[model samples]
Structure formats: structure tokens, C-alpha cells
Target: MKLRNLPPLALAAAVGVALTACSPSEPEPEESAPESASPSAPPTSEAAPAAVLPTGEPQVLATGLDVPWSVAFLGETALISSRDDGDVLELLPDGGTRVIGTVDGVVHDGESGLLGLAVDDQGRLYAYSTGEDGNRIERYGFTGEPGSLALGTGETLLEGIPAASYHDGGRIAIGPDGMLYAATGDAGNPDDAQDLDSLGGKILRMTLDGAVPEDNPFAGSLVYSYGHRNPQGIAWAADGTMFAAEFGQNTWDELNIVEPGGNYGWPEVEGIAEEGDFIDPVQQWSPEEASPSGIAVVEGTVFIANLRGEVLRAVPVADPGTATEYYAGEFGRIRAVTASPGGDLWFTTSNTDGRGDPSGDDDRLVGVEVG
Candidate 1:
């Protein structure tokens, strides 16, 4: 069922309290060295200016969605997945919506529900959802004909991934090699992040049919990398460099340059591990500043959707240390961000998801000219 109009104040109030109380805690401060004693620091080479991001007000594309989580393009239209409900909706060009189909057996709870959606080169649709067995991925055929847009019965591509009310990492994407890649959480078990045998807290690389790719770092295993807490965003640059955004415990959130079999220090270390086998995040943010969710890469820049920060962050792929925040607190808890076929950036708000204060026109999909 479509969700329209703001929920009752009582209901909204109760939900907001619960969500706020359960939100991730602020990160602890790290120790650092003192500043140089020299009267004047050495001059450094000037860096290039950041690329211009989309400006002006965002055009609302579709509204009245029930916790839209992920968006994928299907020809000219875009397909959106609702997290609380199993509905897969089509965002039409005229700013209308249509229920293409709903996934079966989705277990909607706290943070576990229908999550990520991806479209392959062959027009096949892949979705990640929490189910009775566990977190799973399903592949379906899509028919995009006008007035007949629909999704067929899904075939389970992968299953048995860990699931929990929180930390159910459920972002799926098609990599440059045409293989399917999935990011999974630690299922609320910190130890799982360091376990190589478990699929939790790791990125899985597999064929479309769920078989482990031969070139995978761990032969015959789906684990691409280990020691991830709860990664929710993954994107590839033009040069095929992969990047992922991860949630931290009570410390730094991370944006990492994903490498094959790379170990991202999690429970052992939150953000940067100055000296260890673990790789440091290319960029890190305080949990309060960035509960980063969905991300998109456009023209060598990474656009990150911040849940708590309520903003869109643009980080240059060449120099990730330089990040600029945009649309701060104007949209109310941005959840999903995707690059449109026309090179614009499309993002969805999560205000009506029982977390943030819902505006009159909330839970919407908005477009901004990024190109």
C-alpha cells in the first residue's frame, strides 16, 4: 500500500523517540600530535578546486513513499525499493509512481527489510532483503513496457547471509566485470567482522547465479574482503576503482578504497589503524557528522548520503580528504543517492521512516543537476 500524508503526531512522536534513542553513539576523540613549533609552517603546493556539484533547489520527483531505500534505473524510468514494505515502485518521468511488484517473504523489522536494488546489463533486476532464512539476494526479470511494467517471480541468487535488526548490510551492485557484489554487515556480532569463514561484515563477489567468481581473492569463497562493520554503500569509479561507505561503532565512520581481500580494521580498530595489516579508510567522519548510507560516483566524485548529518557530501575521487557538504538539513535524512541516466543526481529522503521529523512533502525522491 502507498503511504501518503504525514502519519499521526502521536505515532510519529513515539517512533522518533525510539529512533533517536537507538541511533549510533557519537565517536570518541582520538589522540593527536601537537602542532609544529616553527613560527611559520612550510607552504604546501596548492590543490585543485573541487568540482562544482549540483546547485539550487532539488526537484521532487516522487513522494509519499514508505521508506524508500535504494534506486535503480530501468531505461528512462527509475525503480525504487521501499524498506519497510516490499514494494518496488517505478518513478515515472511525469513525477508519478507505479507499483511494479513486491518481493515475497520480506521481514520488515528495525533496520532489516527490503534494502538494495540493482539492474544488470541484461535488464535483470536484483534485490537484497531480509527474510526468514537470513539476508538474501534475488534475481528477477523486468518488463518495462508502458502500463505493463512488472517484475517476475524472483530466483534466489544468494542466501544465508547473516541478518539482524541492525547491521544488516544490504547493498548490492554490478561491478565492472559484470559480476554481482554484495556488502554484508556483522549481524551485530563484532567478532564476525574478523572471521574470514563467515559472510558477515564482508563484501561478497559472485556470478549472477550466486557462484563464487574464480578470480575472487579467496578462492571458492564469496568473501571479497573482511573486517567491515556495516557497509551500506558501494560504487565504482570510471577507472574501476571501488569505494565503500561503512558505519562505525562509537567512533569514526569510514569511506574506504575497497581492494580485493583487503582487511578493514573494525572491532580491533574503528577508523584508521596507523600500523597494522588493516588498511585505513581513505576518509573518515565522526558518527554524528556522517551516518553515511547510499553513495554514487559521478565524474570522479563520490556523492554520499548522510542519515544523521542530513546532507549530501561530495568527495573527489582523486583527493578524498577534501569533502564538501551540501543541502545540510534541508531534505531531512537523505537515505539513497543514485546517478541518473542523464547524469543528474537522484536522492531519496527518509524523514517519514520514523526517524526524522516529517515535512509536508516527505519521503520523496528528488533530482538535482550534477552534470
Candidate 2:
């Protein structure tokens, strides 16, 4: 069935970069203009956000990203990113990249492949990927060697997430309390979102090692919240409020305020409801305008990358309940977005990975200066 025709909950089920090895420090804040001011037009050249950088040249953080899917910074000098084609890259201090390893047998058909990535206080790297049977999460040691990990040695930290050629949930991040947080899709089964035990269409909170956390809202279960159709972006701003970006069934894709055990109105509700036991979106936009993916919260603004819109969107968060958007269209087919140590924003382009045509540079890691 087409997405637009899907039931209110059906759309809910559907659906980064750096290189520095430095000390862990607080994320630099992203700047925001007055909410009432109009957004500046996109730059004609490959330059960073002039608002963030008066010098105004978009810097190439890394290149040859190989269908880059997700990214997370390890420290100020080094960062890592994974590709949909199964490759993982490490960006070093020298501004060059090296292949750390390949996620073997990642089912790359449709939208399923190597997706979300995260790291813990212990420095172990975690990833969400399409396994042979379903989507899985695993962890590896940080050896600093490209394509040289003990690939077979990493344990499957979590397994049995529902997987379809499409709707496979892939975003993973470690929360402040040392718990792993993940956003899952509906696996094309609208009703699956309402089923707490199915592991599909839910936001899960688990241990860094994959055990269910005892304090989880659903006691003895990994489900932190239920009733999500397909959530693509997850982030925690300096204030620690968790926010998610989700693709809609057809009408409105959403940026949501996520809480433990919160029901986000998937399968039965989309953006907001006239009346329902579900949380509402802080920000909603047309699907064509923003097929939102990975999200990063710097200072108070949330930077959302778009696959369909092919631009980077900034949402200023004065209040948790509402925000406005700023569009910078310099990047085409942006798939992942993150923050850098030098007070800049980083993003990846996914044009050559099958969604659209390559524009000069098929896939590149670019940086945007922000407040």
C-alpha cells in the first residue's frame, strides 16, 4: 500500500560526521536568530552556513563516504560513520578517512542496511544493522585500525527486531544514564505498533550490553514507549529532553518530544489528533518538504537532515512544545546530521546510494558552522 493511503498509525511504523580523537566535552551550542526572522536563502556555492560562520565556506569534512548512512563523534578529533553498503569509516585528525570494517551480510535491499551508530562511556562502538534474519545491534572494540576489527568477535547485543525490505528501524544511541535507546519502525504491520511485545514500532531503552533496564517504563521489557510507525531521527539536546524525527504515512512528517512510555499516535494517529491518548508533534511539515532522518540538537536548535527535501533544517527550541524551521539547501539528499567539536554542524549526502543522482560529489561529509 502507498504511504499516504495508510491508516493513521501505518505511517508511524514506516519508516553525521566527524573525525577527531579528542577528550569528551560538552557539545558546543547551536545559534539561533529571532524566531520571527525569515531564514536566509541557501548559498550558491559549497560554503558552510554563513550565519554560523561569517567566513562562509562549507568545509569538506570527509569524502568518498561510500553510501554513508550514519555518524557519531568519538571525541574532538576523531569520528566514525557507517555506510548502507556495509562499510564503516573512521575520520582521523589528518582529515582523511579509513575503513574500520564492513558489517558483513547487511541486507541492503530497499532501505535496510547498516544504519544507526553509537558509543558508550567505555568507548565501545555500537551499531544497528540489517542482519540475515532481522535487524540487529552489535558492539566492537575501538582499535583505530581501518578494516581490521575482529569482526567475528563482536557479540549480537540485541536481536529479533522485525525486519522488512523497507521499515527496518536502525537508529541507535546511548543515553545519559548509560542505557541504549533505539527507534524502531512498524515492519509494515500497522497493528504491530500497538503490540508492546513485538519489538516493532516501538522506542526501546536497554543496557549498553543489551539487557533490559530495570527502571524502564515497561517493567521487564525493553520498550520505553510504544505506538511509533517509523522513527528515523533521535537526539538529546543539552537539556536532556529526547526528541525524535519521524516520517509520516503521507501527510505530515513530524519532529516529536519523546518521553518514557509515551504513545506517539502511530497507526491510529499521525501528526496530532482531535482527541486521543497520544502525544503530539512539536513540529510537522509536508512529506515532500522533509522526509526527515537523523537529528542533532546543538545548544537549543535541532538540526534535521532531509532525504526528500535535500536540505538541512534547523528548528529553534525556545519551548519544548514548539519550534520553527530554517532551511539551508546547499547539500543535496542529506541523510545524516550531527555536531562537531569545533562548534560546527556536520552532515552527509546520500545521492549516489540509490535515492537520487550524484551531484558532482556523489557522497561527501560537509561541515556547517553554528552558534
**Highest lDDT model number:** 1
lDDT of 2 by residue, 1-371 (tens): 11111122222222122223211332222343333232332112232122221123345556656778788765543445555667777665444667767777787778888889886777777888888888889887766443343333477888889888777767888877778999899988978899987999988999887998889998899999888888988987655678898888897788787889898888898876644588777767678877888988776667788888766777655443333343335556888887765666778888777777775545777664554
TM-score of each prediction: 0.86, 0.81
Candidate 2 vs. true structure, TM-score: 0.81
Report, for all candidates in order, the number of backbone clashes: 1, 27
Per residue, candidate 1 scores C-alpha lDDT tens digits across 244-267 of 999998878888889899999877
Model 2 ranges with Cα > 4 A deviation? 1-55, 77-80, 144-152, 320-328
Question: Model 2, residue 137: what's the lDDT?
Answer: 90
Worst 10 residues of 1 by lDDT: 29-38
| Ten residues in sequence with the least summed lDDT for candidate 2 | 1-10
